[model samples]
Structures are given as structure tokens and as C-alpha cells.
Target: MVTDLQERSDQINSSDQNKIIIKEISIESEDQNQKKIKESKRLFNEGSALNNQNKYQEAIVCLDKAISINNQYDFAWNNKDNQLLNIIIQDMHYIIRINTKKQFYVMTKLYLLILNMIPIGLIRSNKGILQYN
Candidate 1:
């Protein structure tokens, strides 16, 4: 009868060990998910700052990384959309200013000045509006 009791106790212990292992795995996975989310938020905020500075390509890259890390990041998506709209508006302003005769040279010089302020290695032609390289 002692042998029979020992066999039953060993089976119970094995099951308990499996439960502990499963719980540990679950906790580790949760920690990794939290880290990814935190990184995503950081990237999104950086992208927004870059966007404000008119570094469109760099900003898009950062925002895309944030979205890839966390597909449910709505703020990143919104900011990306806003950046695109700002680019469009910039282009429109260029085209409108180009059509004016007296202000064309002045606007072109102003545009060049603004472009020079951007740190990115992009150039825009006076007639090309917001085209970037």
C-alpha cells in the first residue's frame, strides 16, 4: 500500500510542475507585449516631432515603424495622415504662388529659405512644388 500511495503522489507533483511552467511562460509573454507597446509609443512621438520639422520621409519611416510594432496605434495613424495633408497643402501653396507674377520670385526665394532650414537632404525645384528627394 505504501508503493501505491507513492505512485499517486508522484503523478500529482508532475501535474503541479507543468502548471507552474505554463504560468511562467504566460507572464513572460505579457512582459514582452508591454515592452513592444512602449517602444511603439516612443517611435510615434518622435515621428510627430519630425513631421513638425518638415522631415517628411524620416517622419513617415518612424510612424510606419510604430504602426508595425502596434497595429492598433490610432494616434500614430492620425499623425501620419496629418503629415500627408500638410505635404499636400505645401504643394498647393507652391503652385498658387508660382501662378502669381509679382510675387513669384519673392515666394520662390521664401520657399528656398524654408527648404534650406530643413535638415533632410531633399531639394525642391521652384516649379516642382513639394517634390522631395
Candidate 2:
């Protein structure tokens, strides 16, 4: 009975050792992931600055490069591309006086209204960025 007990203890120790090794690997992988996320966000912030500077052409190039680096990045919306595009669209709305009475509230409402007017199939059929692989 003592010998059987000793064998069981040895088996449990070996199993625990394997678990420790797997856990260490998982920790290392997670650290690498955190580093990548930090880098992606940094690129995003840089893109945003480039946009704010009104260097939209240059900002777009930078944003494209950043996206290629991290396809999952959504920070480009804060950059010059969106800012410029938004300005253009908003100007159209302002020119047309679409809900001009409540500029602040109408802004969101009109924007969504515009978005809704766009055909879903057209937006999703590779016409714009809604389609992501």
C-alpha cells in the first residue's frame, strides 16, 4: 500500500510540472500580444495627429500603412481621412440645410439619415469599408 501511494504521488507531481510549463508559455504569448496592442494604438494616435494637422493626404498614407500592420485597428476613423470626409459631408448637409435648426442634434440625426439612405448592398458590396476579411 505504501509503494502504491508513492507511485500516485510521483504521477501527480509530473502532471503538475507539465501544467506549469504550459502556463509559462501562455504567459509569454500574452505578453507578446500586449506589446502588439500597444504598438497598434501608438500608430493610431500618430495617425490621429497627422489628421489634425490637416495633412490628410499624408495622413491617409500613414493610416494605410498602419492598417496593413494591424488589420484589426479601428483608430483610423479618428484620423484626417474621417475628419476631412466628415467635413465634406457635413458641409453638404449644412448647404442643403438638412435639419439646420438643431445643428447639434440634427448633426447626428442627419448623419444617420444619410447613412441609412445609402444602399446597404452598395456599402457592403466592396463599395466601401464595411467588408473586412
Candidate 3:
């Protein structure tokens, strides 16, 4: 009857309204995700700039913020790792340089002591022979 037709029409309209609302929500979600990605990228760029300026600690803070915003951000994670590694490498080089200097100092002292134990006449003779060679 006409009542049945009216009821079916109401159901179709309600379903269509639901679809439209769902679509709107989906669009909003996409927009929010885009905004998040954009913000994360901005933070990442700041971190990279700081890194280039040799402000490693500051760069790491920025990169950490980027990563927190987007946990899937590979670039932020990679940069953070690189910064940490650079710090470790620099520390290692400093240690090596210090050790090398200490060894050189000890070796120089030993050389001077050995030289002093040798007679001056023998040293002079050997220096003359070395010059001829």
C-alpha cells in the first residue's frame, strides 16, 4: 500500500544520510592525518638543520618530537641514530688521541734515557755515520 512505500522511502533516506555522514567523517580523518604528517615533516626539517649546524643535542630533541608525532617516521629515527653514533665516534677519537699522545710521551722519554746512557763519543760517531748514509 502507500504506507509501505512511504516506510521504504524513509529507510532509503536514512541510509543515504548515514553514508553521507560517514563520508564526512572519513574526509575529516584524512585531513587530520595530513596535518599531522605536515607538522612532523616540519619538525624533521628543523632537526636536520640543527644537525647541519652541529647542534647535535638540539637536533635530537627536534627529531624526537617528530618521531613522537609520527612513530612511523623513518627519517627522524635515522637522524637520531646518526647523531648518537656521531657523538660516540667523536668520543672514541678523543680517547684514541689521548692514548696516542701518552704513548708518544712515554716513548720520547725512553728514547732520551737510552740516548743519555750511550757515551757522547759513540753518539757523535754514529751521527756522523748516519749523515754519510
**Candidate 1 residue pairs that clash:** none
Model 1: lDDT of residue 44: 94
Which residue pairs clash in candidate 3?
none
Model 2 segments more than 4 A misplaced: 1-7, 77-133
CA lDDT for candidate 3? 0.75
Model 3 agreement with the true structure over 24-130: per-residue lDDT tens digits:
99999999999999999999999899989988889999988988888878777767777775665555556657797665655565457546534443311211221
**Predictions ranked by TM-score, top down?**
1, 3, 2
TM-score of each: 0.66, 0.50, 0.66
lDDT, residue 76, candidate 2: 53
| Model 2, TM vs. native | 0.50
lDDT of 2 by residue, 29-103 (tens): 999888877776777777678767766666677777666656666555335347557566656667557556667
Candidate 1 per-residue C-alpha lDDT over 50-129 given as tens digits, one digit per residue, 9 for 90 to 100: 98789977888898899888877777776776676577557657766777664566566656765764556444333323
Give each model's clash number.
0, 0, 0
lDDT of each: 0.77, 0.66, 0.75
